[model samples]
Target: MQMPKRQTDDTVAQAAWLYYVGNLSQQEVSTQLGVSRFKVLRMLADAREQGLVRITVEHRTARALALADRLVTTFGLTEAQVAPVGESNTDDTLARNAVAILASGYLARIAASETPVTVGLGWGRTLSAMADNVTGVRNSALTFVSLMGSVTYASHTAPGDVCVRLAAQTGGRAILLPAPFVTDSAAACDGIMAQRLVREAMGVARSADHAFMSVGECREGSILFQSDIFSADQIQQLRDADVVGDCCGVFYRADGTVADIELNRSTPCVQPADMTRMDTVLLAGGLGKRAATLAVLRAGFVKKLLVDEGLAVALLAEAEKQGK
Candidate 1:
């Protein structure tokens, strides 16, 4: 994600005008230019050195640019968006809404891209909110595949339902994984994976050009805990292992290492290693999910992050404490 040293003069001038005159943030410029915010900062600096911009306009990007730079440098991320949830963020609910709306914009841009797209998705509340807000597009070449199995309830957080809704919104096809997020035993999981439809779903997921997912905290307010998908003893065991959060159904500890638990075997989730191959966008927020979000970031599973300011602050603080 390093900034290029050789950028066109026009590009640098445009970036300078956007930051100093147009009153747009670096994130907005990054989105408009299809480049990283780090690059935009570099371009602005270049503009200053070349005497292209002579005046400074008080704009929001100044603060957002600082935070985004720190996050990308600290986490080694390709891109990071630290969205302002609101002036007052006492409960983190507003932050979640802002993140969902922001994610919808990102999804719409991706759907409108020129190249064909096959997006892989994992289920969670943040992702569900994004699906609800996503602007419908008529891109027949875009396809969505559920990266994990489903929950029984046909709700927003279920993989099958999320994929279906996203596909419907984008005017594409949905390849849902027809199985539970977790089965009674590993043997049952294997039986479902053996099905042709399930195999096809896996193939589609693995072939995705872009992937979107969210982290799940293993706590009282977590969707997994409330869904009754796992027994109380199992949840307790995860706590004993210091399990912080899960991405695509793979639980990991605070240090970002995968937990060696039997529950993973009982779920037909995509391998975490495979996710690193694509452009992965992780959308998550809330103070309650701070630890889990940090864990997923530490695991190096995400290339781009879309998070609220509260969680972004917590992540940077934790990363600094851990010497990340």
Candidate 2:
């Protein structure tokens, strides 16, 4: 009789640590431990079954998970990650950070893939936080491309900045769009887009396998307004045109249709139509963005989403109200 294969406690403990403590997914743990994903899953199950690793789900986390499932089902998204708001549901910064952490984990997993991947990046505080939170990921096969033009002023949340940071973290290359976020006029924008360097960069951005973006609300306190990219009159004009939010420089109305406005024509970036060709992950949070988030989702370009509990609940309620 042959001896049966034995499951070791030491291996189980290492897998648990890598997954639960190190924040690595099963696939990542498998890559690190030189084991199959099935083996890692079995080890994790064994760890839990043996009571060696205690996993507790808080009420807020449980609620967030349920909301995430509803979002995925309602919106037909490939995946939805909702971070628990805890005691600071009203705190936008906290919510953004929580969602960013989840996005960072997702990006890390993508970077760990053996196959080369070109990722397009969009600008926002949450995306900036995601780039900042990425650690210990070094894949030379990765390429980070800016999906939009650079902000006129320096900002960590700018598309170029986020792309560079992600590239640095992953030991990858960064391709920056050599144009402004918004040009002076439509003709100027056309001229810039026609430039060889800008055209090449945009080609890379458009051909990226994966993309990450964030929705910007069309409000006075929005980042676009704060960046001085749009004047008070322009902001009011967007509001007057029923513009609810923007993604990749394409502003949209509450009904998810692109707004026919001067800003939309002048802003040079990846269009919603281009986004439909690739896997796009949208990261957004805060109650202020609830309407904007819904509008972007309705636009039918996002494949995955990462949001906080407050935003998730608001989106679900809004979707039901709209009879979606």
Candidate 3:
């Protein structure tokens, strides 16, 4: 009788290894090893079942992870997490990923709570993109707050648009903050604040069970700068102050400390102290946004920050290389 044929040890090992390492797809393994795709899949399943393949996800951005730790230690954060910026993609994708991750974590926290309620939404394209990425039961009684009022013109979606989106995703009440982003007179802002509806919304914010926001920068196209709101002098003042970035209309100076600016002349929004109190999360990335990113960090607004590899590496290297 012919001797029984032993199983191909190398084939089994290769499939198992590739499944764990992410270097090869089932198709790739099948093509290389002359096995059917179905067989490869089966072998991978067997690998997992038989304990030959195990998976542990290390954070993709090791450098960012380390930097986040250092930042958390230096800044005393509640917690910090970082994601990798894909080598082949733009910074916006990386920023969105970080935002999604942070949002997901916060939503998880809120979901586990008893009272399903009140969430404050920070407006901006970056934030709206994040809201777009959010889905499924957020809260039974979710409330969205307009972190700030409206921008000047341009017809872009309002910041409260993020609130609306959040409400839809998590199934809760979204409180829209409706007042102009900036005003010609201080009285105008005071009058808006005096409105009973706006007051109630602000009160909801004060009792915010969860607050979601992105840092703002004063660049021409920034959420604040480009919203058709800021005037020439206001824009010029921001430039003069070397204000890099902000969160919830909060600006910061070049040394990574909060910079004094003139944005609050129009709207009374969340401050650094309130931010320090809440479960604030920040999302920022991109090679070009180094100044803004650094400004935000120094401003000390982010309790939890989400960042990507390109910007993280650039920020770390720039801070290290040039000592800015």
Candidate 4:
């Protein structure tokens, strides 16, 4: 019985490898693996069920590229990628994942280069999804630095965790900020920044080659409000002050100036000015994030953008409204 089971496992692996990795037809796989076509089909199904095969679909249409070009020219962006929305993709989660897949492909291509590189990371759900999709890169000297303070609880959207995951996926190292995303006071923030390790990691982040981040709106649906990082009152106060969106935990107004709030001083993330020097890519979508995305684009800090069709259309509409 044991021998029979072992033989079956070997046959399954061979059939799967030939069909999936080797790109052989089912008949070819059946013949090469010395199995019937029916057996090959069963083995392929078994491979999928056992998690031996994973498939990803990415749609890049000329229409999407044309939309990206318009965004680039209108906003002075170096590059943009707009994911086409399928008729069935009304759900926000599906749209976010689509943009993340494009972002993952871009990052993977960058990591494939032989040169040493440092990437700065900001925390959000879309950014976390990008880390999940990164594959087939092994950059021994690559480094990922968290550009924001840590979340109190461990989560995939936490800056530290996202940085660690990207480092692991790229076969490199992670540098995390030790302090909270926001301290209670400027003095407390100063105390944390005074630590040698925190200061060193910040220095490295300032010099990083690329910065990848997501924007958040200052409203009920914001991650800042939902994560309990900022109390409802605090978020309401920001909204009252015309804070439209935020990047790297720093709030900003619709006109793109940093919001004049004391909370800015307590944030342990990359400074807004330093962000201009790095090649910044902002990944965000959904109607909830439209205001935030527009604010970031207006600020002119980002060099690249990855967004979905719905968000892209909304952003352009907002821009036209502002122009008139």
Candidate 5:
């Protein structure tokens, strides 16, 4: 049966918006638009076939898709998404923003679920960009929980801030960990983790249905060093210990083993072991993060990955070299 011309056009447009912009599933769109699932599918196909929806990216789309597929196969990832590199191919911010956009889309789709969900978030510039790009989504059943403690100083990229922004954007709730990212000593960290509020928040984090996190390079110019969360001596010490990068607040070596350092012991964040129990998505980009990204993947914390073209190419090359 055919819908009336005007009604069909309106329905097609609405279905496109709900699926593309709203990030709703086909079933959800069918329910909200008061149509059959098969009809919703047909409308979405019509929308694309008629040029009502257009998807544009700056990089070579075909190459990016192939790279994503290779990454999934080589790394044993459940899924992988690669964003195209900009003209310069050297702009770290642009690469990060591209990857962030992919991450934002992933989160939006997850937020559209009918059942309640708890999402654990980690702190970083990329994650902040993801939070900024998320819009037009309203799901009260979604809850964002900070997987790590807050930065000592004010910063929009802090875990607490990212959680709050995500919660605000989705009309959900934010559960923040009320402790410092790193304490002065292991004893201090232990004491903070014992607090009622901190324990409750951590419990929620550990039980999260899914978790999104970014890796940090264990180097001089990394965010941890720039934020003064770690001093020059500390960075040098980590390097001395062969530390390559960190996920959440736990630093690790090139082989994916957690570094046995005092800094790691004093950091209050959900451990990597806990991440293995949930669906963990690792978002990273920029050419400089190749080593760090590889390290995290080796650590086996990532089930899915979102990255830019340059990084994706580098990772594939690394996998080839290692004969993976």
Candidate 6:
């Protein structure tokens, strides 16, 4: 069959534009649109900014969005959100209860029925316990992804595994990220990201509707070091930077300026801007995490904070003391 004349010209323009204007490779464009690599390159160089693309973040308004609002203002989040928890008592119980609530609440907030949702999860004993506590679940099609890998067998399943279990409950999909939380060198993280699974998982994390995470102590390793994610040297470095705690695996100063660490480049768990992409950064965990969570709030990563009465009181008291 003879190729159409007009079609040929369009494809070339599109590929060239993708390459020059969009900073995308011919291979990536081709993969996204199911076109040949040659056409992708050609069109990328030639495509126009006006007609090449249109972008928007779809917001699904909900009651939760309102609660998310109050917290966002209190915490000064770019976007805010809240999740309803299941019943609980123990600290771990409260933590998991929150996840179930978060799951149900996230489902309620989706205004579109067809959009793909990806979630980045950090692991803590509290988060792991939350998985077991999830109840009244609704979503089954959501994609749950792992944000970091494990240094020990005990950490194998991770949030990826928890996502799998939660997905099973909701009938959703689970995408696993393969790289330990901390490594000896940044290059090691870069090497791991080269894998197909790791790359795809990161893409998912970037597009999540909202991220549900807990605070991790940095001066020491919180509960994570027990899992072997960090070494003595890494902890010492955090101490040097006056890192009080961490959010996910990202260490930060009391102000949350991601302390210059050795593992960012190869294994960028997520940037503050990256986390800001979502409308909400739901912060969970307690007591052990009060200082860490507050620093993250001051840095403006989290839009909403979910905590128990006891911790809330402690935070107020701590804040007041600082004021004095």
Error of 5 at 40 (Å): 36
lDDT of 4 at 267: 85
lDDT of 5 by residue, 60-159 (tens): 4888888889999999999999997742388899889899989888898888899999999998999998987886679999999999998888899999
Residue-level lDDT of model 2, residues 194-269, one tens digit each, is 9999999999999999999999998767766777887666677798898988988889899999998788888889
Question: What TM-score, over all chains together, does every model reach?
Answer: 0.78, 0.80, 0.71, 0.87, 0.80, 0.65
RMSD of each: 13.5, 10.7, 10.4, 3.3, 9.8, 18.2
Which window of ten consecutive residues has the lowest lDDT sum in model 1?
Answer: 53-62
**In order, what lDDT does every prediction score?**
0.81, 0.87, 0.65, 0.84, 0.88, 0.59
lDDT, candidate 6, at 125: 56
lDDT for each residue of candidate 6 in 42-71, tens digit (9 for 90 to 100): 464445342343222234335445555554
User: Is 1 or 2 the stronger prediction by lDDT?
Assistant: 2
lDDT of 3 at 319: 62
TM-score winner: 4
Tell me the RMSD of model 2 versus the true structure: 10.7
Shift of residue 10 alpha carbon in model 3, Å: 43
Which runs in model 3 stand beyond 4 Å of their true positions? Answer: 1-64, 86-90, 152-157, 220-224, 256-261, 318-324
Worst 10 residues of 3 by lDDT: 1-10
lDDT score of residue 19 within candidate 4: 93
Which ranges of candidate 4 are over 4 A from the true structure?
1-16, 24-59
For model 4, which pairs clash?
none
Better of 2 and 3 by lDDT: 2
Model 6's number of clashes is: 29
Model 5: number of backbone collisions: 0
Instruction: For each of the candidates, give the backbone clash count.
Output: 0, 0, 8, 0, 0, 29
Arrange candidates by lDDT, descending.
5, 2, 4, 1, 3, 6
Give the worst 10-residue stretch by lDDT in candidate 2: 51-60
TM-score of 3: 0.71
The model with the greater lDDT, 1 or 6, is 1
